[model samples]
Target chain A: MRAVGAEEVAPTSHPWEIQADGLVVRVGGRRGRNAVNELTLRLGRGVHGLLGPNGAGKTTLIRTLATVQKPSAGSLSLLGTPLGRATGLRPLRRRLGYLPQHFGYYKRFTVREFVEYLAWLKEMPPEAIPGAVQRALEKVGLADRADDRLKTLSGGMVRRAGIAQAIVNDPEVLLLDEPTVGLDPAQRLSFRELVAELGQQACVLISTHLVEDVAAACTDVVLVSEGSLVFQGTPAELAAAGTTDHVGDSPIERGYTALLSAGPGRSGW
Target chain B: MTAHHPGEQLLRQYVRGDDVPADQLWAVEAHLESCAPCRGRLAPDPIAEQVWADLAPVLDRTPQMPPARSWLRHVSHWVSPVAGPWLAMILLVTAVAVALDQAGSVARGQISLVLLVAPVLPVLGVAASWGRAMDPAHELTAATPRAGLPLVFRRTVAVLAVVVPGLLVASQLTGASLTQWMLPCLAFTTCTLALGGLIGITRAAITLIAGWAAGIVLPTIALSRTSVALDVAATPVWAAVLAAGLIVIAVRFRTQSRSS
Candidate 1:
């Protein structure tokens, strides 16, 4: 596949593509303990891999970005629109695509129907949907299987269908939580290429435990643990933080281990 | 290259981020993917560049032939996968009630079972329409822009579409006054949605069904007398309850969207 040239243009009209200031998300109740506590980050157009151990609040952060969960305290703004206001949410949602960790599907729905339904939900122009759905399914390598019922698909195919729906709108911001969980090696490679293509213009945040995926596809990395940001930098930068004593086969994996052990206060980025 | 290139007017409109017709845009994009000269002719506007950036990769590949069109594709938005079975079940229940009434079960002045059960059937359908536990795609559906009360209402409408007609037919056959059953039926459905905003839809349906059975159905059966709740004289009360339930649902929708 050909690589599309990156655009060089004027500064964006929006001040920040995605801005989070002292974002605190509580899991259970108003007084419930924090799931994501006092986490602050700013992201612009690129592929960002969100990494952490299990129960590290990665999913919480992804959910908050996806607007599936409201922030209990602090603020979040996407594409220059504040999430707190109800009026701005629909428009923001129009440009947002999210694939949750436990992605759900209507088992009886064919692949084409599933993606088309999501395109409608994202408020795509009805006329533009057919072409867009065609493009999205092709991009995810599911065009041939578009008519197959979701229940008939294998686990990896279902994940690809999830991706097809996410990209059908040509979303400005895409949040994918554990999107690669079911894919084999070849599919993972194609996914990396897809991410690279999407990242050229959109802000793509992927929450996963795979350091290799982050190393291969992500332009930037954010490490979170216990609902707090531990590190933020390029894969090379993360790899540089690793020491000989750290565990894992790859530098990115070692860096991840090293950083988590170094804990909250010692983020090098 | 052919001299028959797209006009400057078209290029300008495309660059200005105007809503170019979809076919025109598709043709232009397909051409631009190969013709770097034409791509260069386009202005350096960031938004246009971004649109092209997103479109170029898609234009390069050959999409597989779309499958044969299915009827489910058209109506799947409002009606869920489980709706057909639920509707069939409702019809079956209605048929059984009609048969029982035809056999003179109500000759002794007892209320018909169909009349007793009709009020909550749609409520059960609405409950089955959408829920976290019921839909396999619930989380994915919830994340979409169209998720929430609007989607819920659409599914409810689908449920009612199946249910109301069946009940109307049953009422005609069993000689039950349409007002006597329709009012309570609508009231129960709206109330289930209203209460569903607090508890879940499934729970709300169960609670309302149980309440209706205990408070009205069981007593009517035991006493072998018509229940005041289903009488035509109680139409005003049922209408009032329906209105209140609608109000509650509207308010709850606002709160739910805001919180989410």
Candidate 2:
């Protein structure tokens, strides 16, 4: 007879860390048109880049997965628990990390303090918090500026600090929306390396318009257009889907434009 | 004295994150900068690797680490940034109202200025406590598990803790009985939160404040008599409103939690 084991049920080994089935999220309160229209996705422990054009509901989808907004219809489950139910949310929340597209920081807070405060909110263990905060800051290359106030930092540095806070808990499900907006090329390169490392253990989902960032760091790419899945495949497959007829600088971008044009509801007002 | 090399022993200590003498650390890092083979000889330690990836462990050990966050910092985390100034403003308003009453600026022979504004003061404070405009991080705060009611209640209580004390002082000084405005003050606060569930806390607070100004304050000032809303005999009515507001709040939270 086999005894129950925590290892067997640990989230890393879980088949899919995030599962969504025909999910719908309405924006602008009730009676609003769906921002994320019937988004269906399954993600496991790996880096999956979410690529979409502007106003394609990428932020709304990321917000829903972060458990910030409730699904107006259908279902969403993270690390195996259904998001709709009223049970065990606190526990689930403790294991999640999110960086909003426009995360605000107290001007007076040092970079370390900001991450530490978020780690506390994420309900990290008190004893583990200090070390976890350190590791996260180091991971994002912000350890040198840890003691500096947020107001003193540059825009790119602030974005890196935001990334540190998001990873402080070593979260099972990490959601980042438009995380590379202010990053310089050198900063973006290191950010890609950090993301590649994080994807090895956790389900790291980054929603962005930068196809190059995803192609460099992501193991899998999921494309959405107008709140619907246009393509879900590896970077190689995405590159293979495109032809010279498509307008782009690279194979991946050409593929993205190709599939997006071919997908239903393309450029329809 | 190996000027070009600090030797393998000192390099090992540095790589293992063991405390090497400061002089040797400087010397070895300097030597490794110019000596390629010496740098290649060091074994990797995971902790030391992270600290010395691009630079050396010296960068991690900054002499002046910022002081640890204090207990007061923790308190402020739950409270909104606007709570302090908003509460101060409430006190200043209360003080002004008290002065108005002392200066014989009563709305009527029976109506005190302190009693007139006390009920709406907390309502205004509630708005400051929860307004997205007031909090720059509202989007991030709303996304957290502790975001919805728990966080809202924390800010609400912080507002009340300040406003209630100020109102008590104002009532005592103005010779207005606490019973006249105390229930209405709390009732308006709860009602703001209740209606907040439908059309945001800030909007609800504004609507309630506007309604109070238009419906009660205007009529009371125009007629030079106490409105029925502020009379002591309407304690039961205020009590009912407070209870109804609390019930709606509870129901709203329940539905919100289940859906979210």
Name the candidate that leads on DockQ. Answer: 1
**Model 1 Cα lDDT, one tens digit per residue, B161-185:** 8888988998898889998889899
lDDT of 1 by residue, A88-180 (tens): 576678788899888778787788888888887777776567778889999999988888899999999999999999988888899999999
In model 1, residue pairs whose N, Cα or C atoms come closer than 3 Å (at least 3 residues apart or on different chains), thus clashing, are A104-B137, A105-B137
N/CA/C clash count, model 1: 2
lDDT of 2 by residue, A1-269 (tens): 12434743654534689998898889996567888888888988889999988988899999888887888898888988888775667778877889999988778878888787777667665556777788888899999999899999999999999999888877789999989999999999999999999998789999988999989989999998878877888999999888999989999999989988887465331
Best by lDDT: 1
In model 1, chain B matches the true chain B with a TM-score of: 0.72
Cα TM-score of candidate 2: 0.81
Q: RMSD for all candidates, in order, please.
A: 9.0, 10.7
Please give, for residues B1-260, the per-residue lDDT of candidate 2 as tens digits.
35567656776788878998888888777877787777677656688778667665655575333445676456666667647788888999999988877887665446677888988998888888776788776666665667667778887888888889998988888777787888999999999999988888989988999999999988888888888878789899999999999999999788767765
> lDDT for each of the candidates?
0.85, 0.82
